[model samples]
Target chain A: MKSDSDILTTIAVQFAIMSFLALGGANAVAPEIHRLTVEVHGWLTDRQFADMFAIAQAAPGPNVMIVTLIGFHVAGMWGAVVATLAMCGPTAVLALYLARTWDRFKDAQWRVAVQGGLVPISVGLIGASAIVLARAASHNWSAVAITAITAAFAYWTRWNPLWLICAAAVAGLAGLV
Target chain B: MPEPVSPPAPAAPIPSHAELFFAFFKITLSGFGGTLPWTRRMFVEEKRWMTDNEFNNVYALCQFLPGPNIVNLTTVFGSRMRGPTGAMAAWAGFLLLPFCMMIAVGLLYERYGDVDVARRLLSGIAPAAAGLIVATVAKMATPMFARFGPAPFVIVGTAFAIGVMRWPLLWVLAALVPVSIALTWWRRR
Candidate 1:
């Protein structure tokens, strides 16, 4: 395969910036990642993005691993490594430093405002991501039903989502969906 | 803030860097759905390393800070235990397994993803995955909506602009975050 250093650079730069934007965690930035990979660069199809998401969610670790999958698709294994490190590395450094003085100003009025302010926005961002993903995934009735049922379970019951994904997979294998 | 009173006395010996690594590594393996419960079990209950209150405080702090919440928890807990190296040790251990496994998953998907069985399975899983995200949003939004404040507006505006309008996230955030903050600050200040 011919090498494309540009793809790796793009992966690193975009994800590194989005690191801070991941306010409510990886899910919060999902829409942005979806935009960049699907809309901007056309690295992955909408179905591929949704499928990679399910794969990452089913696998252990952070929700951000979806970045790794995106990188894998774009630039192969190196893309995967660079994307994961770029997304994770800088933020890890920030956490290390903040762990020290954050406790000192725990009740600082400014800190409280900042935290409170970021919450609704991040929640909204995640909401946007859900919309984008649902649009991508729900093309047919079986898929639509699975999405609704899973959302119900997630919101109402505290059942582990792994089981929900499993049931859906079984349904697909049976060609039910 | 009353300086948080005195720090609680240590319950057990401080974890070494190796101990920190293994602890997180263990959590990763057992972290099927999510790691918070296992992390809490290991740090607070099993290891008796940090008290329940300490774990809660750390977790809240991690969430408030940027980055993946649990990943932040690993960094904060590791740094608190030993120092920078401890942080690195734990971070590495926490990520190592998942990184390898995800790579493997990616490779397999690339090689055989187009095969009928895999496509069918993924198509089934994809919608359910989308539902999971919807559920997550609902869970996050419910409390903000219940409060009957500027928060609901912010959440809705954000969702609308990005989700429906397909605006750029950076610009959307730049336009909204500060206004949201100013509203909150002005109200609370």
Candidate 2:
């Protein structure tokens, strides 16, 4: 059996790498994270991962809460703390440093070029995350329909998304999906 | 006739570190579905910590940085207001309560997650969550892709490689970023 420190170390290393690679945010890295924790490490089942993600979304605050849930599942409290810090620490430092200097370079040609290039990549990563989550969540036609309809509502309407989540829960409890 | 001059606006006070901490803590609590809107509301309208234009500029930079955009924003804003210590306060305030809450959730899941009712609820929620991600992508696409550019190509190519072919993300990005940047630079010239 692996030691507790080993598990924490693994969580730290993997999540730290993911911190930088998470180009579009936490959701963008969802597919890779699922691959690592669920498929590669066998720390969680696909259902468990999906459930955790749903729980994270249902909770208040930021989207990165899923990483905390995953870390907690994989290695308890320390795992959660380490994974969260690793995932957030490097980027926070970068932001701190950049906040000091970014504005000075705001109009620079290369800076503009970088921002222009990264936007599409970020969108693409988020799209990949949607595909990954849909694969895991939509096990049936009804579930697929729920996903599609919700996506439509979110795209075209200004209604609060929490209402859609609540409606879905009712549908599930009523055995519709 | 000359228009009357408007009265000077009140000078907003710089928030103390404690105030920064509590402000972010409260913001996290109120942010149910997403926190970005709340962030803007609190900083711009409620506290007047930043004007609309300043918030947008800072938000743009945060988006460009790696990791979660909101988390980066918290750091950037706090650092601007009160240096590193304030940054720590804001970050801690934003994260601590949520961390505790998630741990509670993890415990609850461990105890009762597999019960039929809970499973059913989760099953319902999962698809909705996935749909939110799709919606986010669509929301991001409209403003930029509406105009003619290399964005559509990069967005589609990146999605196909990662989502469909299941290629490694690192290699795909390594190949794409340089090409995308070069193309953008060339187009601009």
Candidate 3:
């Protein structure tokens, strides 16, 4: 077991790495994080890692919640606190700096180029995240059907998502999830 | 006859840094579930800090960066209004609140994650989580299609092909980036 200081140090380092390289969101760095957690730190097994990821995503709020959950698993309450703050704090500072300078080039050609370039990149990352989630969640035909129907209904109708979530919860309780 | 060159318009009296900070803080704290729709309502319909096109442009830029897109967009918007300090305040308010909540949940989860009810609750929630993702996709796509048309569709199609088909995302991006750039350049020309 790690001491509190060690855990805090680890949290700080991991948070910095994740914050800087979290391009496209937490999901974008997921494959690397999976490697670090399961392979390097041995904090959790691959199966446990996958399960926590599911729980984090299923829970309401930001995807960075995974960092806190994983830290809690590795250490304890302090780990969660350290990890969450570490993950959010430095990036918040950097975002502030970037925001300050953004106005100077409001009409620059490179600004338009960068903006146009990001559209496809975001689409690709979101698509990749969808596929990863599908593979993790859809273990059986029933689960597959749930996924498909959820996608279809959301794509087609104006139904509130809370209702669909409720339906799925009921389905899972019935051993269909 | 020679045309006269017009002088640039004077900048509007923008919000004070503190005002900008609080406005963004409010936006972040109140927005839950999917935030895009609420963000549109606030920025476009309510505060009118930016036009729809400007908001979309900033959003597009944020998406390419790492971290949460909404948080990043908040940084950009806050920065536009009040400079770096405002951006920091907005990001801190937005991320700090959510992080605290998530950490609380994580603590509870660590203590009681293996409980049967917890397991059952999570299992039930998984499908709902999937639905939320779909909801987010639709919410984003609507304004995208309405405003930009074929471009967004093309981006989606390319993404599906690369991600679902297991084609290399880098290669797909490589091919499309130039095409998108070329099209924009041609249109400008």
Candidate 4:
């Protein structure tokens, strides 16, 4: 009873904190989200997390929609709304304020170093996300094959990513994966 | 090279609040692969609101700030145009359609996500989605590895700590960011 409300509150608070730490984007925090939801709380499984990621990617929006789906999964409609807002709202307001002073420091040395520093960490966080998600998404030999082939094609070619997703879906429906 | 924010080249008309909203709404709808490129087109190409230089500067700023880079770009760009409320308008427009779409998708997933067919379909999509992320990381990393430095170690250390070690992220960043910045600062100096 009370625990339900507490859960939502926790979700809101944690997501708010995550927005600040989300260096590259929501993708950069994928590992962190996985840790909190699937590990710390046991609210979701690795499989469920991967599924939500797939659904969000399939939708035509920012990858941040994954947070919306997770919120909805945990606590229904209001949960969804709260998570999305928590994830986006505070950072947005912060961005509004920061934009004012940012232009003045456009070429500041500290700014350059900060950007340079965060760049590697951001890429690494994203890399961590890829590894964590790949482990979750791969369930069998065929699934591993799908991940490998998709990664190869996506890296080597310029075909639209949507096509790869579509092919993967068809293969799945056909029981090939 | 980084430059001061200046309205160089040709200046496009400053967008009204409504224009700001619609431009982003249209970009969200048009974006399939990703919104960033489409945003670049609309702001710099079609609308001419920003020169390429101006856009790049904003990109650098938004990327530096925490949270979603694209979402922050909308806020920063909007605020620049018409102050805070302008920021609200752009943010709302950018998120409105996607938010609705996600809710609807969420509802459907809640109902049917575990059904056998849907499960199979999702199982298929999941791995490929993960694959796409791998490819994305590769592309982002290739540029960094062009010259060997502490960056590769930073990347591997962070990845191992979080992805494998599953360390609490905030603590990891607290430790890593300052050291990483200092190294970069010394290098740049």
DockQ, all models: 0.80, 0.79, 0.34, 0.80
Q: Count the backbone clashes (under 3 Å) in each candidate.
A: 0, 0, 3, 0
Stretches of model 3 off by over 4 angstroms after superposition? A45-60, A90-113, B1-30, B47-54, B127-189
Worst 10 residues of 2 chain B by lDDT: B1-10
Model 2's alpha-carbon lDDT is 0.87
| TM-score of predicted structure 4 | 0.95
Over B54-87, each residue of candidate 2 has an lDDT whose tens digit, in order, gives 7777888888677988898998888878999999
lDDT of each structure? 0.86, 0.87, 0.64, 0.88
Candidate 3, overall lDDT? 0.64
Give one digit per residue, the lDDT tens place, for model 1 in A21-94.
Answer: 78788888878888888889889987788889989888888777888888888888899999999998888789
lDDT (10s digit) by residue, model 3, range B57-174: 6775566665656667777777776677767766665566656666677667767877877666666665455545555555555666676533575557655654466454445556
* Of candidates 3 and 1, the better by TM-score: 1
The residue-by-residue lDDT of candidate 1 on B23-76, one tens digit each, is 999999999888889998898877888877787788777775677777888988
Candidate 4 has a DockQ of 0.80
What's the candidate order when arranged by decreasing DockQ? Answer: 4, 1, 2, 3
Per-residue lDDT tens digits of candidate 3, residues A1-177?
667798779877977766665656765445546657776788887556656765666555566678878877777778777877676666656655655565577787766665555564455455555655565566677777877787777778877665676677678767766
Error of 3 at A64 (Å): 3.1
lDDT of 1: 0.86
